[model samples]
Target chain A: MIHEYLIQLLTIISIYAIAVTSLNLTMGFTGLINLGHMVFFGIGAYASALLTLNGVPWYFAMLIAGILASVLGIAIAAITARLKGDYLAMVTLGLVFIAIAVSRNWISLTRGALGLPGVPDIIRNNFYYMVLCMSIAGICIFIFYKLINSQTGRVFQAIRDDETAAAVLGKNTYFYKIISMAVSTFFAAIAGSLLVHHINFIDPTIFDLEFLVVIVTILVAGGLASIKGSVISVFALLALSEAMRFVLVSPALIGPVREMMFEVILILILLFKPKGIFGKVDV
Target chain B: MLSLNNICKSFGGVKAVDRCSFKTEENEITSLIGPNGAGKTTIFNIISGLTNPDSGTIRLLNKDITGMPAYKIAQSGISRTFQLTKVFRNVTVKDNLLIAKNTSEAEMKKMLESVYLHKPLDAIASELSYGQQRLLEIARALLKPHALLMLDEPTAGVNPRVRQELKLILKNLKKQGKTILLIEHDMDFVMDISDKVIVMNEGKVLREGKPKDIVKDKKVLEAYLGK
Candidate 1:
């Protein structure tokens, strides 16, 4: 039983690490504050669930889910291209509400609030599944590292720093922002697919504020724009949260208390460091 | 090689640039001088495509570039600096030139050296003094080959020593056959460097002539010396 719990814990950490890393591309590197990252993840989960139920291969379902999520990302980026700062944040925040409402009301597709269950496992053994997830996250981090080191990445940073100057230097920043959004959403969907496959369940509630807070807190506490910081923070925070499960607290208070703990940690970090452990620059 | 023909721009109901027309000849330093709010910088903004002229045309090599987006204009061999320099503060000095997407490492080194900003290549731009940051902006602008370079008050807030260095840099750029359109308020600096001068008032050209002619024009003195 302990072994199974360890495998499950590692699996969850792997999935959240991938999601947060993808979010880092936008929120951390590109300097966008994306409150709607969970919408893309949820979209990927539902898409994967629906496709696999219709007899699509698991990898193919994942691909389709990623594509669909990227399309949603592009849509959001195009619609909100002219907005910045608080306006951009509010628009993205609205996307989460919209996504949740769609999943709840579209009973024919998502089964409404009941959600889909018994999602097929990509690999049968828990240990192998965990390894596979870890490998995928590793590959993604490598790719992100390569990308940000390239000329393309420099332009993203330039735009993040001073958009007017970037444009004046011939960056075509609007196009790059859309590309960042699409790429970020594509990886975020992969994380969602991994989540459904590992747990064998799906529901609208999976797109919860808890997930959003967890992802953001991990990024902030880890350090903004630091890939290594993001990876390590994910593992550390997941471990911390899991450790709380054994604290002998009342079962009812566990969830709220854990959430409160994250909020407190995030606040303290913001007040003190504001840059996560590995952050070399500001968000 | 660049011309603005009857360019006009307004904010709400205030006319920032009103039917302003001027041309920057090849390899010449054309200094645009005007009192504040006389719309000199607004003209540069229009030419650089930061703010589209509400009406009228901008031409580069007589090709109508009116209302093109700033980046697209930049791609066509025009570059500009802001009145307040806009260096990417956190990134390394080398990364600033890299962001321009038009310079190799050796070229960037050469460009930085030319600007006398031969600090550590990996130094963060914000670590530089304010004058160095301004020179860094100029270095980043000239990283790529361009037919026209527009500087919006390049010496604003700069120390006199750095301002002297800037004059030399601009003179060197001119010797290499680069056309420059400058907006400056310093009469001595403007007279010393500019091949030609264009005076503006209330978004219209007050006079255009050789620098020697402009300094002696009664209307130019009246506009500058006031009333």
Candidate 2:
């Protein structure tokens, strides 16, 4: 029973590992301050859940969810690509609130605050599902690793360093920016699909600002722009957080203590390793 | 060959580049010299598609390139270096050149040698001296073959020795049949290398001629010496 529980916890960590690594492509590599990135995850979850509930095949639902998320990413990029720094961040923040509002109020689509339940499993056995998600996450990371090592990867980092210089060098920055966001959201959607199916439930709250904070903390703790750092930070932080769950304290205090502990650890890490444990680029 | 016809750009209500027109013949060096705020850099911006001209047409190799995005214009065989060196600060020096476009190992080494840059290939760009950063930018621009190379203040802040090396590099590039457009405040360097000089004052092309004639022009003298 303990083995099953540990595998389930590791599975959740693997799913979020995919999400954070995907976000790193933008936040770490491209220098996009995408606060509302989880909105794509939410979109993926709802899209997949709704389609599967309405008799769509599970694989088809996953594909549609990824496509829908990518479309939204392109739209956001189109509108926000011209805006940078705080303005772009504010726009994405506004989008996150709007997404939550839609998820909370659109009863016809999202069932409002009641949440979506009964998502179909990828594999019947929990351990097998864990293996499948790990495989998917591994592949996603591998593809991103290759992409970042190519010529296109250099341009992406170049744009992050200086957009005008990158453009002067003949890189179509606007196109690259859109492509980066689209690819990132596609993988984020896949992680979302995995999450919804694993827990068999999802809500607007699952994609809230609190969740974004967790992702940011993980990325910072790991290292911005370091793929190895991101992977290590995910496992280490998740394991730490999971171990905290076993503390022999009052259950109510556990949540607050864990939150406070993460904040303190994050502060300490920033003080010593401003770039994170493996950060090559400053966030 | 590159041609600019009546290119004009205004910021707010101030005209930065007004009716700027010129042509660059292949395999010659043309220098744009002016007093500060004479719109020399703005004209470069317009030609390179960094800033859109409110009115004008640009033709490169006789193809219309007016109002194109910077990257498209660059892809059409034009490359430029900024007055402020814009080397990618975090990446290695070699990675900086690779960011422009892929080149083989031999080409990368050749470009570094052409610019006389002896810095280790893996050194971070920001760690280089100001002159080395400038050379790094030039090295990056030379990574890919372009019909025209636009350099903005390439010698600014470099030591005298590096300046001489830069002169040699420009002369060699011109000898190789590359059209060079330059903006410089160094009169001696301008007079030494430029095949022709265009003088601008108050956002307008005040005069154009051979280097000797430009120095002799009364208006050019007054533009520099003041009334």
Candidate 3:
């Protein structure tokens, strides 16, 4: 029983690692304040779930879901190209509301509050599934690491530092912004697919503001603009939350207490270490 | 190599640049000098495509470039430095130059040397002093491919020694056949380096002539110290 629980916990961590690291690409590395990142995850989960339910294979469904999310990400980046700082944050946050309304009201496609259940699993065994999740997560991180060191990554940081300066230097800032958003959302959606397949069910509520808060907390505590920071923080924070499960006497208090702990930790990190544990770049 | 034909820009009710027009000779330093609020920086912005003119045409190498996007203008062979330095504060010196245009390590080192910026290539730009940051900005501008170079008050806030170094660098760039346009308030620096000088006041050109001749003009004197 302990073995199974550990495997499940590792699986959850691996999936979230993909989501937060991808988000770090835009929010941290590129300096885009994307508050609606969870919408991409939601889109991926729903797209993968819908496709797989209609006799499509899991791998193909997941890939398509990621692409769909990327396309939508490009759209959002283009729409918000002129906005920056808090204005950009507000517009992206509005995206979450629009996504929720569509998912909840469009009953025929999403089944409304009654989420699509029984998401097919590619790997039936718990241990093997955990390994697969870990492998994919590792590959994603490796790609991100390689990208962060490339010329494109440098351009992203340049744009983040000062858009006017970047443009004066002859960089097409708008085009690069779209590229950052596309890559970020693509991986985020894949993480969503992994999550739905792991739990074998996904609802609109699963990818709500609460989920965004958790992902953001992990990114912040890990540090912005540092891939190593994200990876390390994800493991540490997820492990901390899981450890709380064993210490808490009542299962009912686990959820509330875990949330309280995250808030306290976030507050302390902001007050003492605003840059985060491994933040290499200033926000 | 570059000419402005009756360029004008207005911010709300105030005319920042009013029918301003001048031409720069190829491979020469042309200085635009004016008292405060004479629209010198506004003219620079209009030429660089950072701000659109109320009505005017800018021609570079005899090609019409009015109203083009700033990046496109830059790609078309115009490079510039801001009135206030705009170096990428978070990144290394090398990364800052690379962002302008990827060049060889030897080339970047040489460019840094030309600006008299002796810091290591790996140094974060923000860590540099204000004068050093300004030097870095100039290096980045020079590293980018360009036929025309524009400096907006290049020595506005630098020490005299750095200013002397900048004077040498601009003179060297001129020897290499690069057309240069600059806005400077330092009278001595302006007279020393400028091949030609254009004076402005109340959004209009007060005088345009050789640096020696501009200093003796009564209108130019009156514009500097109002009648």
Candidate 4:
């Protein structure tokens, strides 16, 4: 039983590592405060689930889901290209509510809050599924590492540091910002597809504020603009949350207690180390 | 190579730049000098496309560039530095230059040395002193290909030694055939290096003449020191 639980926990961590790392590309590296990141994940999950249910192959469904999320990401970036700091944050936060409403109200397509359960598994065996998740996560991390070190990545950092200055240096800030959003959402959607396949279920709850908060917590603790920090923080936080399960002894209290723990850690990190562990750039 | 014809800009009810007109000679440094709020920086913003003119046209190489996006203007051969040093503080010195233009490592090092910034490429910008950061910003600006270089108060906060070095660097850039436009409060630096001086008062060109003649102009002296 313990072995099965460990495998499940590791799989979930790997999936979230992909999500957080992608979010870091926009939020940490590009200096976009994207509060509605989970909306892209939810979109990917629903797209994959519906496609697979309608007889599409699992891998193709996942790819299509990522593409769809990327399109939405580009649209959002173009619309909010002129906004910055708090205004941008508030606008992106609104996206979460909009996505949740759509998923809940679009009964004909999404089946409303009833959700699409029984999502097909990519691999029947739990151990093999975990391996698949880990492999995809590794690939995503490697890609992100290469991207953040490239010339284009330097432009992202420049825009983050000072948009006006970047523009004066002949960089098209709008184009780079949109590209960052597109790449970030693509990976986030892929993670969402992996998540739905692993658990064989997905719903409007995927767009929950709780989930967004959890992702933000991981990115903050990991440090902005740091992919390695995101990966490490995902593992550390998920392991700590799972370890708390043994101490709490009450399934009812686990959810709120876990959230509280995250809140405390976020507060402590902000208060003590505002840049986060391994954060090379300021938010 | 750059000319502004009757340029005007206003904020709310205030006319920040009103009927401002000037032209920069090719391969020479032209200084824009005036008292505080004389609309000097506003002219820079309008010319650089950071602000659209309420009226008039900006021409670079006789091409109408009025109201173009800042990046497009920059791509059209204008590189600029802000009055306040705007270095990418969190990144290394090398990354800052790379963002401007992806040049070779040796070229970037050479550019840095030209501006007397002797720091390691990997050193974070925020770790550098104020003067070093200014030098880094200048180096980043120079690293990009451009026909015109606009600098706003390049020696505002630097030590005297660095200020002297900046003078040498500006003179060297002039010798290299780069057209330079500058907004400066340091009269000595302006008078020493400027091939011509354009003085403004109340958002209009008060006087324009050679540095030697600008000092003797009655209107220019009144603009700087009230009657």
Candidate 5:
């Protein structure tokens, strides 16, 4: 039984490994301070959940989620492209709050706050062997890392280094940023879909600031712009949070103590290592 | 060959570039110099498509290129370095070269050596001293096959000896048949290399002439140097 739980835990962690790696691509390599990146995560989750509840096939829901997230990403890029520096960050922060509001209030499409449940699993009762689902997840994560280190990858880093310099060198940074966000959103959406499918239920509450915090923790605590750091950080955080669940064993410990512990650890990690465990030191 | 015809630009109430017309023929090193506020850099920006002219025509080999995006302008065989030494500070010198370059390995190495940044290929661009950074910018431009290269204040903050080193690189560029437009504050560098000098003051071309004539031009002296 513990072994099965461990597999489930590892599988859950594999989803985050994909999500945070993509975030690392954007925030680390592109040097875009995208605090609202969780909007993409929520978009993916809600997209898959809503589609599946409406009787769409599970695979189609995942496919549509990537497209919707990509369009949303381009829309965000269009809005934030002309704004520079801290202004861009502020615009994205506003976007995060707006996304939460929409997901909570948009009753027609998202079923509002009631949430969606009964999402059919990919293999359903035959999740015993579990070979295909986990293999696909691992392959996707591997490719995500490979792409970030390619020649196109260096161009993204160059844009972060000096935008105008990149522009003059024939790189369209607006195009690059949009593409980066889209790619990041694509993976984030996939993670969300996988999550919804695994849990068989999801709602607006699942896409809250709390989830955003965990994603950011994985990215920042793992290291800035480091793919390996992102994957490592997620597992470390999941392990820490799981350990905290048992460690904080006072039966009287009440009202989201796990969350409080996660918050405390996040503060401590950021304080001691702002660049992250494997992140480059900011100079 | 690159040409600008009747280009005019104004910032609010002030005219920055007014009815300016100039052409850089193939392979000649041209110079633009003037007193403070003469709009030399503004002309550079307009010619290179960094800023659009309110009214004008820009052509390369008589192909109209007015108001094209800056990247397209670069891809069309025109590239530039800023007056303030625009370079990627975090990236290495070789990466800086690759940023503009779309050439093979052998040509790239030759381009690097031409500007004297070849030896420090692995050094962070900013870690190279002030003069080396200037050369790095110029070297960055050379990596591309540009017909017209505009440099704004390429040697602005460099010491004299290194400025002289930059001068040799400029001469080599001239020898290689690359048309050059340079904005310089140093009178000696300007006079030594210019095939034709265009002098401006208060956003208009005050005089255009041979280097010796520009040196002796009375209005050029009075407006620029307070003589």
Candidate 6:
């Protein structure tokens, strides 16, 4: 039982690594604030879950899911291209709300928050190792790394530093923003799918404010714009959350205490070393 | 070829710019000289599309293009440097060159060397001496090899040697057929290098002529240079 749980924990960590790493690509390199990151994750999870549940082959379902999620990312980016700084953050926040709302209302397709279940493990027959392998090797993980180290990545950073200067040099910043947003969203979808299979369920609540808070914490604590920082943040925070439950040893360990704990930690860090563990840009 | 016609601009009851009209030909260094509040920089903003004139037409290559966004205007072949040289402070100089974002490594090196900064490519832009920073601004403007370039007070706070170097580069840019528009307070430097000189007073052109003629014009002497 311990071995199974350990495998499950590693698998979860791997999925978070991919998702947060992709987030780092935008937040770190492009200086984009994407509060609606979970929407992309949910989109990818559902696209694959629904298609395969209807008898589509696993690989094809995943492919379709990735494409759909990436396209959704592009759409959000294009819509928010003109917005900058705080306005951009607000726009993404609205996206999260709207996505959850759609998931709640679209019962015929998303089952209207009754929740999607029985999503087959990405490679089910092989059990723990199978799921673990899928989670680690998912397109999201592979592509996130690839995209960040490219020439495109450098341009994104340049734009982040001084967008006006970048624009004058012939960079179509609007188009590039869309491209970066799409790529980040595609990975979010992959992470979502991993969650769906592990729990054998999906619901609008999976992308709630609390979930967003966790993601933001991971992104911040790990470091903004640093892939390495984000990955470490995911592992550290997930372990902290999961281990804290067992350590309680008293109650089911419910409630608002986590937020308070995080709040205190956030304040302490901001007062002391606010740049995050590995942030090279502004804190 | 850069030209402005009937350009009038007002800001909150103050006429920062009023009834301005001017023309600049290709491959020539043209300087706009005026008193501090006489609207020299404001005119630069209008011509560079940083601000739209309340009423006027801006033409580049003889095509009317008024009220275009600053970056778009830049991409359409007019590049500008700020009065306060805006460098990417956080990045290294090489990275600064890299941030131009579309240059070949060859072109970047060529540009840096043109401003004699190729050797210190690893230095941070902000860490450079005041003169070096000024030169970097020009090199940055030259990085695009832009058809029409505007520089606001390029020598205002620069050291003498650095100022001389900048004048040399502007002369070379003109020789290379890149039209250069500049706002300068140094009459000697402006007159020495300019193929054409424009004298402005109270947001209007006082006279436009050859350097000698502009200096000799009676009104030009009284309104500017204290001659």
Against the true structure, what is every candidate's RMSD? 1.5, 1.7, 1.5, 1.3, 2.7, 3.7
Residue-wise C-alpha lDDT for candidate 2, range B1-227, written one tens digit per residue: 99999988899989888888999888899999999999999998888898889998999999999989999999899889989888998788878988876877677888899899998888988899888998899998888557899999988888998888888888788778778899999999899889989999989999998999998899999999997
Which 10-residue window in model 1 chain B sums to the lowest lDDT? B100-109
lDDT, candidate 6, A3-37, per-residue tens: 66677777778777877777877777788888788
lDDT of residue A50 for candidate 3 = 91
Model 5 CA deviation exceeding 4 Å by range: A124-134, A251-273, A281-283, B102-106, B118-127, B159-161
Tens-digit lDDT track of model 4 for B123-207: 9999999889999999999988899999999989889988888888998988887889999898987999889999988899989
Between candidates 1 and 5, the one scoring higher on DockQ is 1
DockQ of each: 0.78, 0.77, 0.78, 0.88, 0.50, 0.38
Indicate the residue-level lDDT of A218 in model 5: 77
lDDT of each: 0.88, 0.88, 0.90, 0.92, 0.78, 0.76
The predicted structure with the larger lDDT, 4 or 6, is 4
Backbone clash pairs for candidate 2 read none
**Candidate 5 CAPRI category:** medium
Instruction: Please report the TM-score between candidate 6 and the true structure.
Output: 0.85
Over the stretch A1-283, how does candidate 2's per-residue lDDT look in tens digits? 4499888987998899999999999888888888878998889888888888888988899999999999999999988888887888899889889998999999988888999889777678998889888998999999999988888888888988899999988899999999889999999998898888888887889767867877888988998888899999989988888787787377888777777767877788888888898887775
In terms of lDDT, model 2 sits at 0.88
Cα lDDT, model 3, residue A255: 91
User: Higher lDDT: candidate 1 or 4?
Assistant: 4
Regions more than 4 Å wrong, model 1: none
Q: Write the per-residue lDDT of candidate 5 for residues B44-161, one digit (tens) a residue.
A: 8877777999998999877888998877777787878887777777667777777676456676677767776645567777688878888888877767567788888887889987
How does candidate 3 score on lDDT? Answer: 0.90
